[model samples]
Structure formats: structure tokens, C-alpha cells
Target chain A: DAGITQSPRYKITETGRQVTLMCHQTWSHSYMFWYRQDLGHGLRLIYYSAAADITDKGEVPDGYVVSRSKTENFPLTLESATRSQTSVYFCASRGTGRGTPTQYFGPGTRLLVL
Target chain B: AQTVTQSQPEMSVQEAETVTLSCTYDTSESDYYLFWYKQPPSRQMILVIRQEAYKQQNATENRFSVNFQKAAKSFSLKISDSQLGDAAMYFCAGAQGGSEKLVFGKGTKLTVNP
Candidate 1:
């Protein structure tokens, strides 16, 4: 009752469209993640990658696809963006090297579909 | 299963004052790591501090420090000499020992008033 709780933040999307949110990190962290921030649900992971060319699904991976061709870039594509898919998408990266456990995030993409 | 909690929806402080954002987490892994990230109006997530579960000492970065209570599963960030630039959204995250996938909080928006 005293810490962080998911409140109602919102997103938007068209019925059937494709939207790609791109995340790029300059630090070249070996791990990258994609998350969607919403009210009540909080920040839900869509996908993550440990390195270039390797990826895995997170808690909520449906309607979303991720790819990592380079260490610095991780992109999230909503194959068919429904109105429900409209939300704030974040890209994050973290290094595997010593003294690096925090995942730094990209400027979130605010997607609005009408 | 993994979970991170930030109960505060928003917090306000004056410039030059100190503010602490509370976070808590749950994980099966004993050797986990905790993190605090700041996202300004720019929406870019910046690393604030990181606390490794293996270490007894807390983590510090400049004016930022963490109050890591391992037994309590608490990782709170304390920002001393808060500046106007300190106004932003702060998020708490947790990662397991070797898996490295992160579980995040909904976030708390910090407002630094002059």
C-alpha cells in the first residue's frame, strides 16, 4: 500500500495496422527488453533479447514481434495493431559485464491509434 | 515468478531537499539485483542506482543512493540535494541471478519545486 502501484495510463491504436517501436542503446548492453506501460497492468514485458540474433517472449508477447539484428537496436512490431495495442512502449538495455545490472531505457514511444 | 512494487503514485520535493522513493520486489533467486531508473519528460530512462543482492553495502551514484534491505526485499532510492532536473518518473526493477530478465514497477513521478 505504500510502494509503486499501476494506475490508469492509456494508449491508442487503429483496428488492424502495423506499428514498430524502435529502441537503440549507445551503451551496447548485451540484454535488451521491450515493455508496455499501462494503468492497473503496470509495465508488462513484451519481449527481450540476450544478444544480437537471439530473442525470447516475455509475459505478454501476443500481437507483438521483436528482432535484434545488432547489439544496439531492438525493435518491437505490433503485427496487427488493434485499438488495445495503443500504449507507451519502452526499450531498455543492460550490460552483462561487471558492475552493470541496471537496464537503461530509451525515450518511450507514445503510440496513438485512432 | 518475479514482481516489483512502487506504491507511490507521485512525489514532490523542493530543490536542495532530499527525497526517497520506495521500492520492493519478490524473486525466487537468492542472488538477485535491484535497480532504480529515472525517466524525465524526455521519456528516456536513466540509470540511477543499482544494488546487488550479494553485496551488503548499498549502491550510490553521485547524489543518488539506494537503501537496500535484502531481508525486507526493499530497494529504495534516496536523492539528495535534489535539483529541478530531478523532476521525472522513477521506476524500480529486479532481475534474477543468471536469467537477467527484469521485472519492473509502474513508476513514481517526482516533482522538484523551486
Candidate 2:
């Protein structure tokens, strides 16, 4: 495919278990982001990567860890999943930095922690 | 910190009619970017339109358009000739000039009625 793709569209895990959401983009964008969507919060950025081996925390990165070992993949991991982390996670990519490029998003991953 | 606000929690428009979703943001940065994203039941986040703060003219893509008011710090989305496919949750986002993380608003659920 030529677009961004997310794995495990639907996931259900225990509260203390670890879960990882994978995001892969074929465009080889330099910027990749992870966002969590909830009912009243809309979407909140969890983490973002500027390029390979360069990542930063976003608005809601408390329980999530993100790593970008390559330009095409940005994976988000929840070390100890909590019920509060149950939400839909979205991955987006852009060809360049902010203010000069458009972001393309992938199909979200719906995670449920019980 | 930058913040995006979408006051309308929900809205409905008849098919073939026009609908506008209001969005306001708070930021001290002069140069930035604004965006409108659509998420349907499928959970795919799709970019609808984008506007740069420095640009005077509004940005439009097919049936989607934005009314950007820099002075008022408002960026509203106007969907013309609304169709059944337009029913979804629309989010307003803002990105700093040099930052890749996006600050999103509490989305507006837009319904296109037949």
C-alpha cells in the first residue's frame, strides 16, 4: 500500500499487561505522530518522532513510550496498560516539519484495557 | 502552550446544504498551521483542509473549505453541499511553526441528514 497503515485494528488487553501499537508508512515521511482519541477529549498527541532515533513527548505521553528506529515505522508501547489508556490511537505522518506540510493519518487502533 | 477549542459538540445539516463548524485557538506564535480532520465510524483520520496563519486567503479542497480569521484566532470549517458521507467527527488542530506535535480540539460530531 502507498499509505500509512496501523496494525491490530482492535485490541483487548488486561489492565497490567503491556501492549504495543505499530504504525508503518510507505511515504517515508520525516515526521510521525501518535495520538489517542477519546469521547470528550477528541485527539491528544502522545508522542512524535522527527526522524529516525529522534523522538519527543507530546501532550499526553505519561504512560506511552514511542520509538522510531527507522523512518517508516513509529511504534507506541504501553508498558503497563491501565483502564484509562483504553481509547483509539491514531498515527499520522508528514513529509516535512510543521507549517509547511500536510499530515496523512492511518486507520486508528482501538485498544481496550479491562 | 497552544490550545484549540471547538465549541460545537454536535451539529446536523440536511443533504446538499452547507454547514459550518466553529473552532478557535489560543497561541502566541504568529506563524503556525491549522487543520481540520475527519474521523468516520471506521476510525480513519482523514485530512479535510489546512490553512497557514500567514496566508490571507482561505484554503479549500473540493467541498471542504476553511474560514481563517487570524485576528480572532479562529479557524472554522465550512462543508458545502453536505452529503451522507460527511457524517463524522471533525477535529480542529493547530501546530506550532517549528513543532511537529499538533494540539487538537474537542471534535464536533457532524451529521448529514437525508
Candidate 3:
């Protein structure tokens, strides 16, 4: 309960359907990130939020939307999901500090699109 | 833009042996951070080790250590006394000192042979 958690550990949805993956962190870290892990592509950042209401696009932001209404919550939404979007989604949080700030990751949500 | 590269697609090591996973990166920033993350079958991304660019000493955690060559832009992970639990996908990542985004490499799948 003291770590980050992602909802819908496993999801299967049809293409073109809208889906939202939730991420909640109890640490209240200032930085939160969403990443998609695919074979041959370790992990690509989809979106990140520095703080409440402050979000930025990451490497692969297409077809994805993210919002951070609170410091502990950052949700990623697939407005129109595609088969290509099916992958393991990971949410990570990091505190603002020095000497290579460590990131805490949650058990990823595996999404499959048909 | 920074890019991380993991050339080895797969590797294997006998139990209790040692294995090294290679990683290379391209970045113009002088100050940054490097990390190695392991993902097991459970799909949980866990931090293995971290190295700061400005630090001359490599970082180690338990039996996992890094051979960091700043001039060569190489950060390789060496796992000693490998165990069955060490079998997983290991990813190398780089992040700028003050930036929130992390650039990740294509992971290397490690297999521990009996």
C-alpha cells in the first residue's frame, strides 16, 4: 500500500475502443511517468507529469492521453485504441533529489487489443 | 536527443556463473544518470543498479555491479554468481541530470541455465 499501483493488471479490448489505465502512488512523488514496454523496445515513455496539473508528452505520445489531477494520480487514456497499442504499460514515480534519483515502478498492466 | 543501445538481444549463463550485459548511449549532456532495470516474468520493472555520470566510481548492488566507461559511453552490467532468479529482460536507461524523461535501450534477455 505504500508503493505505486496500476489498475486493470490485464485488459483485453477491441480495436477502436476507448480505455483508460489508472496509476496511483502513495509516495506522492513529484514526478510520475507512463511507459509502454514492447518486445525489442525495452520501454518508451508515453507521458509524464511533473506535478499536479503539469504534464508533458514523452517519446511516443500518439494515440494516448494523460492527465494528472492530483499528485498521487496519473492516468493514461487510449482515446481510440489500436492493435499496435497493445503492450505492457508501466507507471513509475520518482522523488526530486540528487545523485541519480531512484524510480519506483508498479506492477505493469498488460493490454491486448483485437 | 539521447539514445540508449543494447546490442545483445539475448545471453545465457550457467548457474553460479557470471554474465555481462552490454549497453551504450549517445548524449551531449555532461551531467546525467544511467540505470539498469530488470523485468521478470511477473512484469514488474525493478531497479538493479544506477550510475551517475559525474561519479568516477561504478555503482553496485549485492551481486550486481556496473562497469561504467564514461569516455566510451558504455555502461555494462555484470551479474556474478547468477541464479535462476536472474533470468529476465534487462534494460539500460539514461536520463539527463535535470530532465524528467528517460531514454531506454532495447533490452537484453538473460537466461540462466541449470
Candidate 4:
């Protein structure tokens, strides 16, 4: 309960439908990231936020949208979910400016788009 | 852009034995961080170990240790006295010093045979 968590552990949606995956962390970490894991392609960063109001795109940000209005919540939205978007999505958080830059991840959200 | 590569897609090790998973990376930046993550069937990403490029000494944690070759741009994880609980998908990831994004390699599925 103290670490990061993701909502809707599993979801099924149709193509062209809009869906959102919610990620929340209790640690109030300064750095939060969203990654999608697929077969043959490990984990690719979709988006990352340095702070509440500061966010940037990562390797695979196309067709995915993210916003960080609050430090604890970073939700990923798929405006038009496609079949290729079906994968396990993960949310991670890490504190910056000290120690090891290790990231703690939450239980992934398995999304299936038909 | 930095790229991490895990050559072995799958590996099997007998219980109480040792297993090594290889990982190679390509990065021009001198200072960076490397990490090994373990994901079990539960789909939670757990940090196994970490090594910084700036440090010449290898990093070890309990049964897990990394043979980090800075000159070869290679990082491999060696798990000693492997147990059944160690059966999972292991991933290699890297992040630049000033960047919040982490580049991950295709994971290796390790099976423990008892």
C-alpha cells in the first residue's frame, strides 16, 4: 500500500475506443515513468515526468498521452486504442538527486484491445 | 540514443547451481547507470542489482553480482546457488546520468530446474 500502484489490473477494449490506465505512488517521488512491455521488445518508455508540472516524451510516446497535474498521479490515455496497443503497461517511480537511481515498479496493467 | 541488448532469450539452470545472463549496451556517454530487474509471474518488476559506469569495482548483492566490463560495454548478471524462486524474466536497463529515461533490453527468461 505504501509503494506505487496501478488501477484496472486487466482491461479489455475495442479498437478506436478511448481508455485510460491510472498510476499512483505514495512515495511522492520526483521522477515517474510509464513503460509498455511487449514480446520481443522488452520495456519501452512511453512518457516520464520529472515533477508535477514537468513531463517529457520517451522512446515510444506516439499514440499515447500522459499528464501529471499531481505528483502522486500519472495517468496514461489512449485516445484511439488499437490492437497493437495491447500489452502490459507498467508505472514506475524513483527519487532523484541521491543514492542509487533504482526505480520501483507497480503491478502491471494488462490491456487487451480487440 | 543508448541501446541495451540481452543476447540470451532463454536460459535454464539447475537448483543450487549458478547461472549467468549476458547483456550488452551501446552508449556514447561516459557516465551512466546499469540495472538488472526481475519480473516474476506476478508481473511486478523487482530490482535485482545495479552498477554505475563511473565505478570500476563490480557491484554485488547477496547471491547476485554483476561482471561489468566497461571497455567491452558489457554487463552480465551471475546468480549463485539458484533457487526455484529465481525463475523469472530478467531484464537489463540503462540510464544516462542526467536523463530520466531508461533504455531496456529484451529480457531473458530464466527457468530453474529442481
Q: RMSD in angstroms, all models?
A: 6.3, 1.3, 1.1, 1.1
Measured over the true interface residues after superposition, the C-alpha RMSD of each candidate is 2.1, 1.4, 1.2, 1.2
Q: How would you encode candidate 4's per-residue C-alpha lDDT over A1-114 as one tens digit per residue?
A: 679999999999999999999999999899999999999999988999999989999989999999999999999999999999999999999997646478899999999999
Could you give the DockQ of candidate 3?
A: 0.77
- Tens-digit lDDT track of model 3 for A1-114: 669999999999999999999999999799999999888778889999989999999889999999998999999999999999999999999997665377889999999999
lDDT of 2 by residue, B50-88 (tens): 898989999999999999989998999999999999999
Query: Which lDDT tens digits does candidate 1 get at residues B1-62?
Result: 88899999899999999999999898877888888878787766777777889999988899
Lowest summed lDDT window (length 10), candidate 4 chain B: B95-104
Q: What is the lDDT, from 0 to 100, of the residue B13 in candidate 4? A: 100
Residue A37 CA error for candidate 2 (Å)? 0.7
Can you tell me the DockQ of model 2? 0.77
**Decreasing lDDT order of the candidates:** 4, 3, 2, 1
All DockQ scores = 0.41, 0.77, 0.77, 0.79
Against the true structure, what is each candidate's TM-score?
A: 0.85, 0.95, 0.97, 0.97
| Chain B TM-score (each prediction, in order) | 0.97, 0.98, 0.99, 0.99
Model 4 misplaced stretches (Cα beyond 4 Å) = A98-100
In lDDT terms, how accurate is model 1?
Answer: 0.81
Off by over 4 Å in 3: A98-100
Choose the strongest candidate by DockQ: 4
RMSD of 2: 1.3
In angstroms, the error of model 3 at A47 is 0.7
Q: Least lDDT summed over 10 consecutive residues: which range in candidate 2 chain A? A: A95-104
lDDT of 2 by residue, A26-104 (tens): 9978999998888898888898898999999888899888899999999999999999999999999998855456778
